[model samples]
Target: MERTFVKDWRGVHKAALALILRCIADHGSPPSPAELQVATAAPSAETVQHMLQEMESRGLIFRDPGSGSILAAYPLSAVPTPHRVRLADGRQVQAMCAVDALGVALVFGQDTHISSRCRHCRADIEVSVVGERIGAYSPASAVVWYTPAAVHCAVAAEGQCPYINFFCSREHVKDWKRDLSAPRGQILPLERALDRARAVFNPMKGLGGGPS
Candidate 1:
């Protein structure tokens, strides 16, 4: 893991981040600077914009390259993905990626219900979360694989990649390999997978074994 120091909260406002997240939860996406200004009443729209820019630059969130609106912040995604994290509070949010679904539960400090489809079989896979403990994955035993962030700068790009997958079992992974052009990712057990998710959400922890 390269020491890419993420100075958490330096020159950033927790309230601003919370406001953006609240917008996402309420509106299904981040508000525009104008909307954010109206919602936060943060003196001016420019101030809100500056705070957003600072957040993105600090790796606290990922913004849309074109719109500059919040695209993602860890477990939450402005754009929907197959991975969904349903909070115990009854608020559901889409995750940026497979590992991110797990990170969502960790970040909120609540039980979560993760729902996604297997990359190969397309069979529904669901996992339960109780605090830090993860329940047995549905569709039987499963393994998660991803390219470690330490090796590749973009562990997850703008869209889904074959590198991130959930195999109902190792045999299914082998079955999928036959048709692939190239192979990638390291298969991880449930516990190690959760640990990797923790490292991913905590940039200060640096890279882990895999993304999710």
Candidate 2:
């Protein structure tokens, strides 16, 4: 297994970041800069924007170009991804990726309803997760595959592809791999996937841990 490490969150206020996350969990999105200034006691809206830019440079967050609002940071996203998780308490949120989708279940310790569509066929793939086991699956044969350590090359603008996904069958994944001509990822069981998400997104539990 590859090692996992937390990102450096310097030049960003830890309490401010924590408050932002708390707001997301409660409100489904980060508060606007003006609202944040009141909530976090930030110096000014301009200073908050500067702080956001610093966090973005460090890969700890992504902000909108026009409004400077947060698009995504770790477990949360303003724009939706393939993975959607619904908690038992009726709260719903989108995750950054598949791993983060399951991480939401682990972080909340709730029975979760996870849903995503097969990228190749556009067929709905859904699963219910109780603790670590799949409580139910629609097709009863769906499998998840993920790259353990997907690489990223900012200079060449390569290696930044979607790393995890569900497939109806191994044959579907085989067909999909013909385009990339790269090794496919290993199948991940539900429990292992959830554990991996916790390691990346919620490593510190009650303590404040920045995005991986």
Candidate 3:
């Protein structure tokens, strides 16, 4: 493994860790520095790379040579190849930006189309928050983590977001598309708890037996 000097940003950083987890949970991939740049509205690309390198060295993520982007630290399956995003409509839109950090900042990818799937993978590139969709067809969505049992729910669809209610199991999740006018952020505490748990997915398993 290529060893990189990493800085210690320790102990339950809700933002960074949440971003990392949200990336994989939703998009099936990690967010890159460039994506971070757009999401954070960074001044320059190099600044995003610098901070990203810091996170990478700390064993939270790995940089991919194929795309020159950051990927999750865990040994992942081959990126759900040819993953495409089909919109709510019958049209197949190209996806460029991918905001995976559940609910921090929006993450984007290399494709500039912003309306179609990436040429490389077909994962849903756009995301929507609240009633507004992020890319094109994404609806009010929230990635919720049910505590203890580790159930991860990432939903982007029409109707009210059932994830707002806190329940032990199955009540609200079954109704993800109910009441269209339900107040948002009602389930924020549940989201916060899930975001806090992202530290468990640390990328520092030691890059081994692969590209270095």
Candidate 4:
């Protein structure tokens, strides 16, 4: 992990990317950095500029030159990974988590949903590519209790990828799904989502006696 991002990431040059990561951890995808600067009430223009440079040098993020927007990042791996747990409900969840390059975790998860994170980098300037992990079940494993609005999604009957099968309350899953658009809005690709869902999530060493 890069020390630059931690000590002075609240608002800096690439503040857009830092904000993006925070937003993604919570809402996933987000408004532009300009919009974020205004929203977060960043200190000064120079501060934002410096932060961007710092992020780029550290290789914590990727960026889009044209749009000047932050791409996704491994919040934990990029920063310091947070912890994930499995619950008795048979779902894996992380607390306000993010994945870094090595895949570190960050504690997140407020209410209803969590905020995701993204990074901005100087490399890959010619292209526009942006990107963007979690957990098992336990008494404390229930993340919905922390977020309150958590619903359930059914994972693989055999107990695979906790991200899709992470087990949100059906109502919560329905609520989260309702936010999607059209075909994508109604359906969730747990399997596909699993591909990107690794890092932060860890199934219980021994859990899940049945399937959903």
Off by over 4 Å in 1: 1-13, 35-44, 150-162, 181-183, 202-212
> What's the lDDT for all of these models?
0.64, 0.60, 0.33, 0.32
Which 10 successive residues of model 4 have the least lDDT summed?
Answer: 120-129
The per-residue C-alpha lDDT of model 4 at residue 28 equals: 41
Which is superior by lDDT, 1 or 2? 1
Alpha-carbon error at 101 in model 2, in Å?
0.5
Q: What is the overall TM-score of model 1 with all chains considered together?
A: 0.76
Q: Evaluated with TM-score, which candidate comes out highest? A: 1
Top-lDDT structure, candidate number:
1
Clashes of 2: 0
- Encode model 4's per-residue lDDT on 1-212: one tens digit a residue: 11242344633334454445445444445455555546445555655556655665555444445664554333321111223322222333332221111122222221112222211110110100022122321222122111212122112232221232222333444554455431222222322333333323332101111211
In the range 1-212, model 3's lDDT, one tens digit per residue, is: 11222233332222344444445544556666565555454557775676666666655554555665644432221143221333222222222112122222122211111222221222233333222123333213323323232222222232111232222223343353252433343233333532432343223211121111
Clashes in model 1: which pairs?
none
**Candidate 4: segments with Cα more than 4 A from true spot:** 1-18, 38-43, 76-212
Q: What's the CA error at residue 100 for candidate 4, in Å?
A: 4.6
Give the per-residue lDDT of model 2 (tens digit) for 87-140: 777777666666766666555556678887675675787878786456787666
Score every model by TM-score.
0.76, 0.72, 0.29, 0.31
Per-residue lDDT value at 25 in model 1: 54
Q: What ranking of all candidate models by TM-score puts the best one first?
A: 1, 2, 4, 3
Quantify how close model 4 is to the true structure by its C-alpha RMSD in Å. Answer: 16.8
